[model samples]
Target: MSNKSSLNLEAINDFIVNWLKSYAENAKVKGFVVGISGGIDSALTSTLCAQTGFPTLCVEMPIHQAESHVNRANEHIDQLKARFSNVFNERVDLTPVFEMFKNQVSTSDNEAVLNLTLANTRARLRMTTLYYLGGLHGFLVVGTGNKIEDFGVGFYTKYGDGGVDISPIADLMKSEVRQLAAYLQVPDSILKAKPTDGLFGDDRSDEDQLGASYDELEWAMLEVEKGKKPEDFEGRKAEVLKIYKRLNSSNQHKMQAIPVCLLPDKLKLL
Candidate 1:
């Protein structure tokens, strides 16, 4: 929770730009590969990548994407391309790929699980495509996740949206991301648009799925970080704490590295 008085947009931008430059130099990658879903997070990230004077490949991989979502993504990419010489935009429709995948693993009498599986598959497919492009051109995949999604509640799918070589905005909360987006002159329509993962065909918003707005979730997470209990909320204690706990517990795995088993010399002695 960065205070307004302490938040310096220019400094943040400068730092991220330098970070990207240094990271690419160290990795020996040519540029950044990003999946642009028209969300402000992607918009801000790609914009920052472009500012590094390195190629920023913005791929719009629409698998049953809503028309509005596609339009917004194109609009943002157009803005980026117009402003930056290093910006590149491409569209790859993955509908057939998804349908083929859905047909392969789907079983009868589990429509709900199958539906969720399909959504996650969409994310992984996009990830695969981004990595393919990244490998082809020696670019690192630049993730579009923010603090609340990547760390707070872990809203991203593991090895799906969670798979990336670098995460520039993963520490900025959703509200702070909106502030940065506004400062970066992101289009007003995208800045005000409801946040969605754009994975579902019906286009459910992130808040609709999370059971609470990002502002509420961010505040609750901060309170929990400050050693405040649910009882501190008084009126909304039960409601707020429930959402916070459910999200953190369920999505914890996404935030953690993969677990590995280890054997010790003491075990050999035994």
Candidate 2:
């Protein structure tokens, strides 16, 4: 497996920036909009978008977001705006909107299901806000998902964070993301902070929810690609493999293309 030390950070950065610029120009859009989550992924994404020289709008949609998250997000946005002439930012507090949505929906007796549903709701609401802003400004909604979250474990909401016009860093692993982030001068605060989706209004790290670190998950993903099975491993390795497999299986719907019910030719003719 290729390690982060072997990555050509400068070349990778140039390629992604050029790609973002070319896609936006070909699509005939004004610029790009990204939801800044104060995490490494979003920081790197917004930075790449800004480097494209297009108008990159970094939006903070906080719905009961933790103070650390808000601070890091603001810090990163501020740094980006100061560094790049094309960078812009917006703060849209969605706490009240989320509360109103909860009131409109029926309550669930299952605590786990209810919490999960609300977390997804937060993601969807942020997605809606991003699209609304994008539509108004002719900006493409840029996604902040990394390779592991988007493909390996499907750690993102279906249409929420998954809904994006373009993904610049989806091809890079989590370790590679941190490498590029440091190369691009992302804030030290975010670099050191724990990764979180920030949907549950708490400080629970992504590792806490995934049951394995990105390093473990990446190893398991690579092993699976090499046709390895759970029985081939033992101890902590086996546990991590099972965790990776469980998430990969359950989240295939998110990773794969949406299903379309196609009618037969005869039925269509009839």
Candidate 3:
């Protein structure tokens, strides 16, 4: 998010690889299981996992995913497999599973909420598939979300993309991720590809839904973090602030831990 590019890709890669290896050893897990969506975040995350010398299960769980998205996903996996001996690629199409789910849910009057529910179902189904694979193979589910998506706007689904044993690049901003992906030699096509969750049939990009570019959001998020008010943006204050507030407020729930009621000794008597 900072205009200053201070990220040391080599160091980041080394740190992530070491973390994965140590995590696997300490957690007694066999390897890392990653859900690849052909996006830069997943590609970078999977690459880091593969570099750890542990068997990395790179899965493409496509549920009504776009053809371009599918192609890019395969290309990235092929590249990773070609270079990293520990990289194992798997493609699990969940279209049938999603269709079955749609059939089961009762029709609702609110079409908008229904569509959103179905989209969230797609993400949760993918989460289920990742955990199933991890459970069967004794691997840890590695998530692909970057800082901007995971924290800035809470762009990920809870118990869905948000479900994972580890997150390697959750601290890196979207811009920083692109820089790291380029350094990792992620395929040029993938490195230059538009960022999308590939969850909807309409094939909308993240920027499209967010109504602001990652650069803009990143700047605004940083400003918010610095305790700067919307008025600080000067001429574009109102416009940028609107985008910032809408995104931060709408997705705040995803960024937080599940709520639980705590009881003290006296309250426990109830």
TM-score of each: 0.95, 0.98, 0.95
- Model 3 regions lying over 4 Å from their true place: 1-4, 235-237
lDDT of 2 by residue, 1-270 (tens): 333458888999999999999999999999999999999999999999999999999999999999999999999999999999999999999999999999988998999999999999999999999999999999999998888889999999999999998999999989999999999999999999988898888778899999999988998898899999889988988898899999999999999898999988999884
Model 2: colliding residue pairs: none
- What does candidate 3's lDDT look like per residue over 1-270, in tens digits? 344477888988898889889989999989999999888999999999999898999999988888888899999999999999989978898999899888887978898888887888899999999999999999999989988888888888889999998999998989999998999999998988888887777778888888888888888888888888776666665577678878889888888777888878897685
Quick one: ranking by TM-score, best first?
Answer: 2, 3, 1
Over 1-270, each residue of candidate 1 has an lDDT whose tens digit, in order, gives 233335799999999999999999998889998999988999999999999999999999999999988888999999999999899988989999988887787465788887787789899999999999999999999998998888888898889989999999988988888888899999987998999988878869998888888888888788888888776666665577678878898988888878878788799894
Report the alpha-carbon TM-score of model 2 versus the true structure.
Answer: 0.98
Residue 143 lDDT in candidate 1: 90
RMSD to truth, every model: 1.9, 1.2, 1.6
lDDT of 2: 0.93
Tell how far residue 24 is off in model 1, in angstroms.
0.5
Residue 158, model 2: Cα distance from true site in angstroms: 0.7
Question: Over all chains combined, what TM-score does candidate 3 have?
Answer: 0.95
**lDDT, residue 267, candidate 3:** 72
| Residue 78 C-alpha lDDT in model 3 | 96
Clashes of 3: 0
